[model samples]
Target: MDQQTIINSLPLHLRPFVKQQRYDDYTPRDQAVWRFVMKHLSRQLADSAHPIYKEGLERTGIALDHIPSIDEMNACLARLGWRAVVVDGFIPPAIFMEFQALKVLVIAVDMRSVDQIFYTPAPDILHESAGHAPFIVDIDYAEFLQRFGEIGMKAIASHADLEQYEAIRELSILKGCPQSSRQEIETAEEKLAKLCNTEQAPSEAALLTRLHWWTVEYGLVGDCEDYRIFGAGLLSSLGESQHCMDDTAVRKLPLTVDAVMSPYDITREQPQLFVTKSCKHLSQVLEEFAASMCFYRGGTESLRTAIAAQSVCSACYDSGVQVSGVFTEVLCDAVGNATYLRTTGPTQLAYRDREMLGHGVAHHADGFGSPIGHLKDFSRCLSEYTIDELKAHAIEIGQPTKLEYLSGITVEGTLQEVFRQDHRNLILSFSDCGVTDLHGRVLFAPEWGTYDLAVGSAICSVYGGVADKESLQLFKPTPRTSTLRVDVDPSLMACYSLVDRLRQQPAGLDADDGSIEDALLAALAQYPNEWLLRVEMLAVADSNLQQRLLEELRQLGTANKATEQLVAMALGDFPAPHEDRPASA
Candidate 1:
């Protein structure tokens, strides 16, 4: 399947986030970066990573030599029951999860700069494709990833979380760009720091992201003492992959629902990693955590979470009716079960995820309020009462009716309408109504206009977001900010292009061509400080020139410990070294 066909198949709402991969946008240097990262990451992870990783890379459509194209990848992904779509860096987590739930991988379009070659702060194409898509070949891991999306998308998030998402997204984009100034980064950091302190408590979505960060992003697999690399954050990263292996610096713990309790810092290396017993164990731990979320655990327990979010949420009553709005208050009974709930803004009444007729945000534009317990003498729910039975009891429409609740609340009004669905009363509207507690504190007065009391016996469930998704766009995913492009000198680009030409040769080309060798030597002379060029040149250079390139690399490595480590690692494990290092370090 082609990218366009796969994209056309997506939900209309998600297609806006999908972008075209301008394969032409990648420069020769960019391809070199991809090759370098994949080459070393693969060799380093051969034994350390999950065994399927190498096979997965092949099964999925990633190539070791250059950046993988979407067309080839989508074709390969389709065979594994998945598809790939390119997105701009760092889409909203909920949106990302939604795509995953649909079994479509959200591949970020931006490639990391060579400057941040080890690891980039943003969700670049390298991380999204090389880090994530490789594991899609494994059925168990794929199912776990898809299931995570299904649950995570429903997780309730606070309005403040939206602000934080934009902040973090901005920081990642700026930091990933080589040309971004230190002052600009500091400003973004300050804003993100302020948002961090603003969160009084982690919302359901916030907590779920912790689990995702720990597992999908940076998780390990197997026992704490003996684990393999499965996390994309580790697999795509060269530095963290090695840093995490040091037992003294990075602690390893058994995977559990408790991982959610410890939040992660995306810009910094994690201090700890969670290890699952197996891929199946990942889903088990996920279920354990999910079972505790508001969407799964309903009633007053869930309502409080929604109320605290201070954003659009929904509460399902025992009568099967759901009210969605920015929840403000929840009156409780002696045992703390919700007795009466009130929403202070536009609220919609929905049943089975569909809006109820005559009751929507427009009708209740001001707000909504209703009781949520059984009637004083009723052995069953008020909604369950028959129309004839209600009329016999003097609660008929168009007549004066008064009712008492078990919670010491009373309703007196001229019943104007009884809204029923499948013979079950969903709402009872009244004119000239007066609702009050035993203490005579009026909940609703006659002057307030018609009162539409939701006819439910009790609160059954409460979760985040509107029950009817089509009701309102309460939250929008933060769209991606463009990654910056730092221009390189033409001569330097020419040199990179020449190296790329050598790399793509049917049979490995030696630097025996005088003009090619002169250009290589001129590049080495003009950009003497560059080490990656030397590394790239070392691969295609014959024995005679390899000695000269190795000498240059050694000199470059000596200036800094980082370069030293890179050259040492790249030369030792780069898989294309044609010459042996000198006996002297």
Candidate 2:
């Protein structure tokens, strides 16, 4: 089957979600992510992975230069009687199984942002194209996958199963969202916890999917003592793939249908995995599974009995530790923004555990899963101390402590505290590493002279090294806090800084300098998504600079959605409507 044929075969409801893999749609960042993950994982997986995985990759012609085109991949898959198609992100388990049954692979269209370089909760090109697709070329393995899918589709699941699908999707988006605050992610996790602990038992389909997840997604192959990577989940992950092989603590058990059907959490690392004797043994196990599967023999009632006996899977919590007045805990997961279990109460010093994952916390409440939203800027309240006070505190704590500044730069310091007086904020601190901007550019090193960085502006490090940290044209303060903590990209920050500075200067035309706007235009070349941020910056600029920014926006043309929205905003005249701006743009 070809791309269109595969789409046509899918249920009409699912067809709209399937899209052509527009190879040109990928950006430089996407390419870089693909290259970085592959470069690191290739050597690690070479000896550890099933031999066919590397061979499939070579035959498919995926390389470091760019993302593979689906058409090209299908041409290779055709030889093995398989085809590949791209999906928006994650699909329903039934739809996913249907694709597998039809000998079609579903690749996620979006690539994870750099912030989630290690692992993304969502399936990406790395997991789909690079991980699962490579193994499809092994004819016997492919046949086993197809048969499993065929059997899987017969399993019945309730509507409640879909809740987890939405929860995970929302969690992935929130993690990658630059604007999402720490509190927001925690709240989302709490909601997910409630859904996971629902009174209803998991359906037959959900049970089968769990089995598929453990084996095909995160499974290992060989004896319990020794194993190789065959699962797509490990094969795609740079961290877990290596960790699974190197960590002796990770339990590897002999493959069995019962072990594979056991419940597992998507959030945390696997404490135990089922390992098969060989690739062919996988088929043998599936054959045995089919004979006993509820889908074929026992039906939904038996699957419900199994689900009722299974324990609820909850996210693991970070080891509790208190630094000064701040108490922090992280909800452990395989990847993405970890939810923090924080408190500002009296500190209790405990031995912090090294490996925090897999030790499941209580499902209902208390400890890690206790009600969230109690702590707010737990570290910010103690910012009142002077440099001397901070140094004393650091010695008392016995650590290389640091403090965050209102200016968005974090400095190496000791016992510092916060004071509030009207609107303006101040911090008294000392530093040995000196003060560095949000972009990691050293603004004040001991040997290096003090330098002020603006958007699109350049500076030399203490070692005299130069890189691409440009001064921005804007500075939009986040709603949750006073003083910018600067979580946004520097390019956007530079654009924000530009317009902010201009707004402070003069509103109308200024003859002082056009270089500021010129510099902004140059910076915008690489980061086109900075267009909306630039638009916000333009509102603060003088009339001349605003016009110049508009002209630059026009010059950018409608190359992509970001530029297209920018051009539309420019043409719409001054004061672009906020609601009209595309979220992606």
Candidate 3:
């Protein structure tokens, strides 16, 4: 399929989060940050990262010297059955997974600032494109990513999940913006920390996301004791990648379903990492977790899970009809089998992931409710009954119909319609129907409008979100906020622009003359702490200027260990930072 065709096929709800890359928005300094991180990361990762990392970079069209645009990535990714879209900051996790399930990668729209060249807490182009896209060259890993998305979208989430996601997202946004105050970042950090420590039980979605964090975000390949870097988190962060392999600081655990028990914090470096045996093994562990999710094992338990979540979800009946809405209550019998279930507001009925004719949310805007078990005399689910069989039960259009269930739920009305698909009756509509439970409690009043009964014996599967996502937009898309653009003084940008221009034209620098070095020194005198600019100046500076640049860098290096290491790294002395641990890492 063509790239646009594949991307357009993504669900309607996900499109709102997608934004234009606006390639021109990247400032000259932004370009410098991308080059600095990519050049250094590629060099160090050349030895420790997976072999696929190097080859994938070429195939994926991730440029080491420039911030790659969405169109550029799409051209290359389309060849591998993938496409790229730009998104601002953090999007909802569920929406992100949905995009992935369609084989579309969402590249963050912003680049990290020069100060955050080592690591940025927020989602950036560096983390999403350079960190992730390269690995898609491996077919096995690509499949795993899609499968992860498939399973992730269906996993049941808790009420706190969105709140927690928003907290972390806020923190990342605050940290990424260069103008953000210390107090703002600290407040966001406190809020996220509190949410992390909440006493509420973890939901299936939360646990499954934990597994995603371990394997896809920060995973290693090989044995627990020894491994190569593959996860995007480590692959993107210069400091984390260097320090992560350390045994004393970050414990390496063997990848398994149990990895879900270990939650991750986005604000801090992980104290531990999981190592899978291979790329294929990543999916194996994921499937193990998938097998345990409510979407796979549905019944009264899954219904209860949906009720606890208090969000939009889908429950598939054995008869192949699906009810999608916020589950409010479930009525069970003496032995604990669900007798009837109800959804509160705006529900939809779907079959095979498509909205049924005249059974969308508009038709059932108030809510939807139905009996859960087989009828008294019918050994088969009512949906399985043929037209002739229903005639035997005196259930024909415009005829009086009375249905009794084993759970004492009764429906009495004149049959209005029977919606069928693939030779199965998916829904039965009745006029002036009065539904009553065993205690004579009216489930549905006769005065109400047409009663649409979903046909099924019991819920066979339950999952997050509406079944017909393309037809039903259940959640509101978070408003897109543009990532922080560098709007600094023009003079400051002039220096960065100079360095950026120097990179594009290497021949501009002449060792025979010290003009370029003198120009850079004049620029540096204004911005005293622009260490990266100094490091960039090192490449083309003559011996006299190179010595001067080193001396200045050495003085700036004393300000902090990160600076010290960067200057040392530029000089190639002591391998700069700790490959095992950056200072205080």
Candidate 4:
């Protein structure tokens, strides 16, 4: 099933939190804002953000030009044993933690406008994808996050805190709505400010949330005297990210339970930020906070820390949290999707396999793995096909794809050609056709009709057969104009080709006719502004190819705005900030 259809079919309980990244929802202005942020921050963040932050950006497939696709992100993240899911703005703290506990990164799909680009009052795509998604690439950091989520889920908040969460959610939803007026937004922001500025002390849940904000949201990394931003809040906002680093007025302190327990303001620039020495330090601080929790103090020891010490059977070389460099013998079912109890020394192992009945082994029929910790190969599934099989499954050549317009009119042809106009709108050429549709319901009187060919409506094939909704091809309509001009990124063509190839069968990394990558790279070199497309294709290339592309990008140097941003993003070292770069919004 297509992604949108699959999302629509999901049960109501999960639907709101897990939605599709409707890439088409983004408008031209949104794309412009994304590029603006990428161009500026890619250069501005050179000396400020943690090294892993940029690596995470590359690893997770987040690019500069367009809003990221969560499915594509998950494809890359899956290699690191993680996945990305789209959420509708801010979810409950506990729910957010629950998602992380499952090793799933929750991303907000909405993008901020150019006006609100510098600092979005609530969670948006910039904050989630650009700020948070990249850091998950580091195993230690990923494990630390999962553990934080596990702990945060149990850290119950007070009624007052819940009210604050609801208020924040309402404001975020309002801001994300393109139709929301300035007055309505101001009204919401006013109410949120009052809630944030309240003088009352925060509850345990609120304090824990504060900790999350200081660390995950606005926290810094490195020694107390010298640090860089790893926090999403700092990473996503151009104004704050730069101000926090440049302005000596902002106080920096080591990350600690006490430090985060203090209150903070959301409406204006923060006067202070806490820095952590490393992810391990954050983990230690988290455990310290967990130990002090009212729930833990009430005599219920967290199962997370216990399994590590009491359950070892000795002489094992398996998976799970590593303690004293010993493997914790994690088992799994026929497929690797379900991880069993008592796995590696890795902390994520505990939260990942929390349903064990005894000795970290699940009671289900998957059966407990022997304590011998022998490595099992579950790389390919029983029904999976090889690369050779995938190549054989490619769609037959010379078969022209069919696209249906308004009314009974049909356009049968292949993608005649595709290219970017100055690296902005993706231009696709279809075989010319004489106007038909005498009835004129689909396209008549020069009206505007936008349709997603894949799932929006029924289209017929060359054999006069109705197209299946499961098909991935989408037929988007251009505005009411003489020439067909659609405002989509040109990189989408290569993306469509890659997805089509993958759906047919798993292919090799450098496996296509090379036309798709060739077209993408040609566009990339021609349009320096197409950095996101470069990042997207680079993420798909095999390791060796990615390195080669990096070298090619480096060779370009600080030639232009696009190439400079491309080289900086492709390999985290950007040339000295060009005075010509976009000024902070």
Question: C-alpha displacement of 342 in model 4, angstroms?
Answer: 36
- Could you tell me every candidate's TM-score relative to the true structure? 0.90, 0.52, 0.93, 0.51
Predicted structure 1: lDDT: 0.85
- Per-candidate total of colliding backbone pairs: 0, 32, 0, 17
Candidates' C-alpha lDDT: 0.85, 0.55, 0.84, 0.55
Indicate which candidate wins on TM-score: 3
Please give, for residues 361-477, the per-residue lDDT of candidate 2 as tens digits: 211012221111111233322323344554555522334455443334544533232222222112122234365544665545645322111110011110000011011101121
10 residues in a row with least lDDT, candidate 1: 471-480
Q: Give a tens-digit lDDT track for model 3, residues 1-585.
A: 443554476667777777766677777777777877888898889888999998998898888888887777888998999888877788877888888898889888888877777768788898999889999999999999999999998988776887888877777777888788999888888897888787878998899888889988999999977789999999999889989978899898899889989977775789999999997789889999999888999889899999999888899999999999999989999998888989998999999999998988898888999999899999898999899999998889899999999999999999999998888998899999999999999999989989988889988899998898878976565544345554667786777777667666757466555666667778878878878777777665666677777777888888767678776666763233334856674
Please identify model 1 stretches exceeding 4 Å from their true place.
Answer: 357-360, 385-403, 414-424, 477-482, 485-491, 507-513, 560-562, 573-585
The deviation in Å at residue 533 for candidate 4 is 19
Tens digits of lDDT, candidate 1, 300-379 = 87878888888788888879999999889887877887878889979999888878887888899988999888898788
Q: Which of 2 and 3 is the better model by TM-score?
A: 3
Ranking by TM-score: 3, 1, 2, 4
